[model samples]
Target: MGSTRIAVVVASTGRPEELGRWKEHILRQTLQPSRFVFAVVKPSDLPSSDAMLPCAEVVYCNPGLPVQRNAALELLLGATHIIAFFDDDYVPSAYCLEGIVDFFQRHSAVVAVNGSLLADGINTAGIPYEEAIALVDANDRNGKPEAKVICSLDGLYGCNMVYRSAAIGAERFDENLPLYAWQEDIDFAARVGRRGGLALTTAFAGVHQGVKAARLAGVRLGYSQIANPVYLMRKGTLSFKAGIRLIARNLVMNHVRAFKPEPWIDRRGRCKGNWIGILDLVIGRDHPKNILSIRQ
Candidate 1:
C-alpha cells in the first residue's frame, strides 16, 4: 500500500453514462485511491448497474455542485490523507492520480494542486469512445511540459483539483451560489492558499471532454457568471479587478457568440442572462443566491 491514503470525490448529476466512462479512466490509475466516493444529487440519478463500480462509497445529496462537493467532505472525516475532485466529464490519464500523490509527497509546503487540461473545448458531443481515447492520448503526448511542477498559481481548476487533507480542516465548498456556482473553485483554492502554496503541475494531467448535455440553462449559467465573481469580490475572496475582468470577458463572449452560437452552447441565452445580471447590479439587485429563482 502507498504511504499516503488517497481518496477521490466526484460530484455528478444526471450523467450516469459519463460517470461510468469517467470511472473506467479512474480505475486505470497506477496508484489507486483508497476511497472512491461518488456523490450524486439523487440516488435515482445513478442507474443500478453503475452502483457496481469499484467505489469505496456512494453518497446522495441535494442537487448543486458546491453542495454535492461539500457533502463528500462529511464522508471523508477520517478516511483519507489526500482528497481530489474531478468533474464528471473529464478523463484523466492512468498516471494522473499517481503523479498527484508523488507531487504532494515531495512538496510538503504545497496544500493544493491543479492538473493540466489536455483537451477541452466548447463542444464534444457524440464523440465515440475510441475517438475520445485517441483524443486523450494525443493531448497527453502534446501537453507534456519540461517542468514537472509549476508553482504559485492563483487557484485550482475545478476539473482536476487535489488537496492535502490536513490543509483543508473544517473548510468546505461554499454552497450559497447555485447551479454552476461560478468561481467556487477559485474561492476554495484561495482559502486553501492562505494555509500553503498552490501549484499547477504537468506531472498530473487530464482531458476535459466538455460534455454538451445535462448542463444548466444558459441564462442561469450566465447570471452566475456575472453575479458569482461580484459576490466573491464583496466577500474578499476575489479581487475587484479580477472580478471585472471575468465579467467583461463573459459579457463580450456571450454577446458575440449569441450572434452565431456553436452547436452545443446556448450563447444567446447566456447573453440574455448576462444582461439580467448587469441590470440587477444597476438596480442594486445583485445576489448570487438569486440563481435559485431560475427554472432549470
Candidate 2:
C-alpha cells in the first residue's frame, strides 16, 4: 500500500509515567505511523524533554477528554488520513499501525476500526513478559474480515479506535456532556454510522494499564459510565426504545457486578443531570458552544 499518513491521537491527563511508557511502545512499533500527536490537558503537566517521545506534537486542552480530542483532530486535520485514538495508559503492539493500515486499504467502505483492548493493571513489570506477548498475539488470532456498520444502541469504545479523516469531516467529540471522559465515543460513532460510515473490529490490539481512578482527581470515573449513554439517548442520537433497552442491560449488569453500594444511584443521578440536560436543550443551553466545537 502507498504511504498513508496515519495520525495517532493520545488524549491524556495526569498520567505522565503511563504516557512515557506508551511513548516507548510507539517508538518500538513495527509499522511506524506517518505522524504521532499527543493531546494533553496541560502541556506543562507532561514530562521534561528527556521523557517526551521524539516527533510527537503535543497540544494542550482545557482539562476535558472531548476538548482534547477535538484539539487533536484540528491539529492533525491536514496532516493525516487516518486518525487513531488511544488512552494515555494503553500500550499498543509493534504492528498496531500496520494491521490498521492493511485493513483500511482492503476495506474501501470501512470508516473506522477498533482494536481489542486487554486490561493490564499499572504494574507492568510485575506481569510476566510471556503473558503480555500472549495478549498481543491474541489479537492477531482474532482478526476477521467483515464489512458492516456497528449500530449497537450503546455505541463504541474510544480507548483503541481509528477513524477516517474525510468521513468525519468537521464532526468532533461533543462537549456538552462536559465530563473529562465517557459516552463521547458512542455519540461520535453513532453519528458516523447513521451517516453511512462503517466501523470495524481488528485483530491488532493494545494493553490498557488499568490506572486507578483515585490517582487523577478522584473525578468519579464511573459517573460517565452511567451518564453519557443516558445523555445520548435523551439527545435523540439513540432511540428512546433502544435507550430503554440499553439502560436495562446496563442496570442488570451493574447489579450483577454490584455497581456501587446503592441500587438507586444511577436512578437518582439521571433524574438530576439528565433532566437538566434535556431542559438545557429545550432552552438552548450552550447550543452555540456545541456547534462551534464541531465547526471545521
Put down candidate 1 lDDT per residue, 1-296, tens digits, no spaces: 38789889888888877777755776667778888888998765564675447664788888888899888988885779899998877778777777888888788888999887766753545455566678667755654333367657888889889998989998888888776777899999998889999998876777777776678888888888888998999988899999999999989887887878877778888887888888999999899888788665
Each model's TM-score, in the order given? 0.92, 0.74
**Which candidate comes out best when scored by TM-score?**
1
lDDT of 2 by residue, 1-296 (tens): 45788888887777676677666777767678777878887666576778888888888878777888899888888778889988776767777887777777776776777765565554333334356656766654655323233342235667777887877887888877564555578778777655444554543667765555413221132334344555777777767786667656654544454434343233334333333434555665523133223211
Scored against the true structure, residue 196 in model 1 reaches a CA lDDT of 93
Q: Tell me the lDDT of model 2 at 225.
A: 38
> Could you give me the TM-score of model 1 versus the true structure?
0.92
lDDT of 2 at 188: 84
Candidate 2's error at 144, in angstroms? 13
For each candidate, the alpha-carbon lDDT, in order, equals 0.81, 0.64
Task: Report clash pairs, candidate 2.
Answer: 30-94
